[model samples]
Target: MCVDSPLPHLDRPFDYQVPAEAAAAAQPGTRVKVRFSGQLIDGFVLERAAGSDHEGKLSFLDKVVSPEPVLTPRVARLAREVADRYAGTLSDVLRLAIPPRHARAEAAPPAEPPPPFTAAVDGLAWHRYVAGAALLRALADGRAPRAVWTALPGEDWPARLAAAAATSLAAGRGALIVVADARDLDRLDAALLRVLGGPGHHVALSAAAGPSERYKRFLAVARGSARIVIGTRAAAFAPVADLGLVAIWDDGDDLHSDQRAPYPHARQVLLARAELEHCAAIVGGFGRTAEAQQLIETGWAIEVGATREELRRSMPRVVTVGEQERARDNAQAAAARLPTLAWRAARDALNAGAPVLIQVPRRGYLPAVACADCFTPARCAVCSGPLALPAAHGVPSCRWCGRPAADHACPQCGRRRLRAAVVGARRTAEELARAFPDTPVRTSGRDGILTSVPGEATLVVSTPGAEPLADGGFGAVLLLDAWAFLTRADLRGTEEALRRWFAAAALARPGAPVVVVADGGLVAVQALLRFDPAWLAARELAERRELGFPPAVRIAALTGPPAAVAELLSLAELPPGAEVLGPVPAAEEGHERMLVRTTRSAGKALALALKTAAGARSVRKAADPVKIQVDPLDLL
Candidate 1:
């Protein structure tokens, strides 16, 4: 029995005796209540054993939770693998893999089998990429063909993904497509309905769905009633039988990273699942990630992208803030945020009766503020948190503590007045509405998000990832305050910035103007101009390799009280060639972080060592627990 305990010391499965009354229901994969440590706890029957290995008598299971088997052997193995890969407990990984039980949903009658589906293998969508058609053919032939696809600008990615899924279903195999979020899932759901001709053939899974609904859909997939599953991150482990194709869209999106323990990325999970299931896989996105680039570099996956000719025809015309524009603005371009050139582009697009898209890095009215006198950052005296203005004339307040900084002064300058340090989507929208008074203006961000907009003469200001889709795509795309993204302290700043730019730029109509407000010489800006995300990704990957950073080497981040961190490192049997970075001060007060690095080849060993040490600490019931994150997204 695999006890549902997250404690690393009790991570292993324990042998249990089944009472004769419940023997019939205590089958492998079924949820059961077992007595562990003198307390009744939930557990899964991994498998039946002929005899007990323990010399002592095995404890009998208290009772079976349900006769219905929710866990599958395949998923159980996948969960175990994920746990090992992330230096996390198997129980934690299992918790992520399986959703909470909804008894009512399980008791409901089984969903009717889907109607017969005959997929039409449309080669039109794949014609742009050289190997795209081949990928579809391989899927139809039930052959696993791993690929890292760079989606073309203005591409109907949902339709393309649906086509791939259709191809796999045609071969009598299941397909799992995990997108970044609900919006993407909805689009894919619609496309699948159109391509497969109905809802029964596929199920859309998301955490946002009501518990009953989510569990119902999950049951459909687990029971093999649904052959295609499309969902957000958690659906990466959806139990699709005879899985043929596993695809992930926008693998670089931070939304794909789980916030819970083990913190497995959807892309990595899908890749690992594909390898385990001997199925085809596709990692397609508007922008590529260094990890995806590594897959291609290591020859584990082939690249599928449009040729130069096709790219030119499909991509919008991209340009950065040029020297002429800067000269015309008298070097006030930075201060203006939206320069004259950007204004002209919006005007031209409006004149053409097409909507324009404006992407802001921040989401509120004024996310950051500074002292007017010395340009020093304004902070809250009580909490030392940066101050922000929620409205045009609103008093500054501490963003962290939420305390009004009515009498705030800059510690550095002792100034009473404050100025906007970061202009966000709301404020940008206000400015645009005033500039284009005659045209309708809309904002999409944290305050209020829009899914789609009508294609007409209007202006749409949005934060990155929240841009609304226009009917025929936006006529122009303006990326404001590029420095906010590029200047972030994280290592993936440039990569993430480029991703946001590409995602926003891809929303423009072919041949439309996409302007980025940044120096033309910057690598990210140049890559955006050329619409070559793969090139930028490759370059970044090479730089990371040279610097011995992630994708080249695996680094485990251990953050906790200083003593706890030191104890973990001392106890861990680090793999050979492991390099320890620092017990540097962490973001949390009185805590520090230490980074342990090792070659990619030693990653598995390193994870095992850490896991063992963590288990040892758990056995000792260490006072302070160290938080271990393998391949943490942020490595400042």
Candidate 2:
């Protein structure tokens, strides 16, 4: 019995005697309640055996949670592998893999099998890439071909993925496609309906669904009634029988990373699943991640992308209002958030009856502010946190403590006036609305997101990842305040900024002007101008390799009280050549973080050593548990 306790010491399975009454129901993969540490705890019956492995008498299972086997053998094995890979407990990974049981959904009648789908493989979208057609044909022939695809600008990616799923279904195999968010899920669903002519052939799984509804869809896929599964992050683990294709869109999106323990990325999960199940895999996105490039460099996956000529024909004409423009114009124009050139582009697009997309780095009105006189950042006197204006006429308030800074003053120069240091989507929308009074202006951000907007003349100001689709794409794309993303103190800062820029830029109509407000000399800006993310990704990966950063090597971050962190590191039997970075202060008070780095080949050994050390700590009931994360998203 694999107990559900999260204690690292009890990570392994334990022997349990099944009562005769429950024996029939206590089959492998079924949920059961077993006595552990003198308390009844939930567990999964991994397998049934006639003889006990323990020398002492095994405790009888308290009760059978359900007769329906929810956890499949394949998923169980995958969960175990994922747990080991991340140095996390199997119970934690299982929690993420399996949803809470809804008895009504489980007891409900099985869904009718989907009608046989025989749609011809439409490789129109894939044909743009050199190997796209071959990849589709391989899927149709039931052959697993792993590839890293770079989506072209204005590409109907949802339709392409749906077509791929249909091809796999036609081959008598299942397909699992995981996107980044609910909006993407809806788009994929609509495309699937159009391609497959119905929804019965596949199921869309989302956490936003009600418990019963989500479980119902999950049960359908588990029972082989549905051959294709499309969903957000967690859906990466969807139990699809005879799995053939596993695809993930926008793998760099932060939403793809689970916030819970173990924190496995959807891309990694799908890759692992594909390797384990011997299924085809595709990681396609408008922008490529360094991790994706690593796959190509290692020869683990082939690159499927368009030629330079095809890219030039499909991508928009990119312009950067860089140092040359600043020199040509005045300093004021250079300082302006929406410069003269950006204004002209928006005006030209609006006059042509096409919507203009303005990509803002932040979401609120004034995310950051500074003193007008000395240009010093405004901070809250109470908590010393940065003060921000929530609205145009709103008083400045502490973002951290939520206290209004009614009598705020600059600590450096004692200035009372504040100026907008960082303009957000709302403020940018307001500015554009005033500038283009005749045109309708819309904002898509945290306040409210617009999935799609009419292609008519308008100003659509949006934050990254919330850009609304425009009919025939936007007339022009404006990437505003590039510094906000470019200057972030994170390892993936430039990569993330480029990803957001490419995603927004890809929404522009063919040959439309996509203006970026940044220095032309920057590599990221140059990549955007050329619309070649793979090159930038490759360069970044090479740099990471030289620096011994992630993708080239593996690093595990341990964060907790300083003493606790030190204790864990001391107890850990680090692999040979492993280096331990600083136990520096963490974001949380009284806590520090230490990073353990090792070569890519020794990543598994490093994880195993950490897992063993953590288990030892758990056995000893060590105080102050340290949070262990492998390949943490943010590395300062």
Candidate 3:
């Protein structure tokens, strides 16, 4: 049986004897209870045998948890492959694959399908792309074709995905669609229902819904009742029967990265699933990541996107406010965070009876506070924690401990006065409100995001990912605090920054002005102006290749206490050409981090080596635990 044990040493399955009374229910794919270490544990029955292969007496089954075979042969095989690929335990992968079975959900009556969207697929954005038709043909004919799609700004990508899914469903095969987040899922789910004609045709799986709802959807997919599945990262493992296609939208988004053990990304997981299941794969997004580019470069996937002429016509007009222009008006720079050009554009947009979007990088009233006198960061007088304002004009308080800083004074400057080191969404909204007192200003961010802004003239101040769509799209978009995104310590900072900017700008109506306050000469900013994520991605990949960084080379990060991490690395039997960098101090006290780099061909071997080393440590009962992350999004 495949035991539900997360131990590295117990990765493989063990044989167990089925009692005569429970022999009928102990079939393969059924969840069972087994006696391990004198304690009952859960396990999935792989197969039943007439004869024992062991020389010694086998332990009898503790109990049969369920007669339903939730773990299908395909899912079981896929889970095993995923575990091996990530060097993770089977149990962890299975935990992702199969949620806890809810009996009430299993017994629930089948839901009738919703009305199908009978709209024709002609004139869809995907039809404008070169390889789009070919991809659809492959899915329709049950031919496995892989492609990387770059969606144009304001494109109805969900409709395109639904059209592709319809093609698969027309055939005798099923399709699985994985998006980055719940927002995308909601959009795609509604679109898919419209195209495919109902809830009976496809099931939407996401943790955003209640447990019962999620379980019911999962049950439908597992029981082969629903041939199409759409969901967030977790849906990548959906057990749809006769899978024909696996498509992931916005693969560059961090939400696609799994937060659980082994931390498998939705893109990578879908890629592996396609290869293993012999199905078509599509990685579609507005901005291409280095990893997706690598797939195209390696001929693993074909590129599908609009032509340059089409891209130019589809994108909004972009204007850049460079440092030179800002320097030309020092008073404007000192007196206002928004450049004069951006202010003019927003004013013009509002006057034109259209809403304007202001994209900020941070949220809250005062994200960062500093001393007014010496320009040093303000800290809590008692706890020494960083101080911040919880609300507009509110008293300063320590962000860490929530202690009020009413009587606090700056240590370095010895001043009681404080300044806004970093302006946030609320602060930006406050300033914009004051600047345009007659115009209505709305705020959107972590506190509560707006799905759609009220129509007509208003200024919508939002952080990245919180920009709401206007009725007819925003008349203008102002990308503020460009330096904040550009100055992030992560390796993908530039790529991420461009993505955030592009997403907000994409909301603006075509021909409407989009003003960016950043370095115009920078490649990322230039790409935004040109509306070319492919160009930026290609450039980023070239630089990474030259530096021997990730996407060019596979890298894993190991973090733990200095001594334990060092010891683990020392014991690792890495693949040839492996390079180890740093035992640098980590953000957490007493912890350190290191990176192991290797060629793409050697990534599996490297992962296996680390897994084996970790298993050895586990067997030895090591006190310090090391965390290993492969292809981590944040490499700070």
TM per prediction: 0.97, 0.98, 0.96
Could you give candidate 1's per-residue lDDT for residues 1-636 as a string of tens digits? 899998888989899888899989898889999888888899999998889889998888999998887788998888888999999987898788888899999999898887656756675879789898888888889999999999999999999999999989989999999998888999999999888877799999998998889999999988889999999999999999999999999998999999999888998899889989999999999999999999999999999999999999989998787534553443333333467788888989999999999999998989999989899888888888889999998988889999998888667767798888988888888888777778998999877889999999989999999988999999999998898888899889999999999999999999999988888899999899889999999999999999999988999999999999999999999998999999788999999999999999999999999999999999999989999999999875
What C-alpha lDDT does candidate 1 achieve relative to the native structure? 0.90
The residue pairs in collision within model 1 are none
Note the residue pairs that clash in candidate 2: none
lDDT of every model, 2 decimals: 0.90, 0.90, 0.85
Candidate 1 stretches with Cα past 4 Å from truth are 322-337, 412-414
Evaluated at residue 44, the lDDT of candidate 1 is 91
Candidate 1 structure, TM-score to reference: 0.97
What is the clash tally of candidate 3?
4
Mark the regions of model 2 whose C-alpha exceeds 4 Å error after superposition.
Answer: 323-337
| Best first by lDDT, ranked | 2, 1, 3
Superposed on all Cα atoms, model 2 deviates from the true structure by an RMSD in Å of 1.7
Residue 59, candidate 3: alpha-carbon lDDT? 90
> What are the per-model numbers of colliding residue pairs?
0, 0, 4
Candidate 3 lDDT trough over 10 residues, lowest sum: 114-123
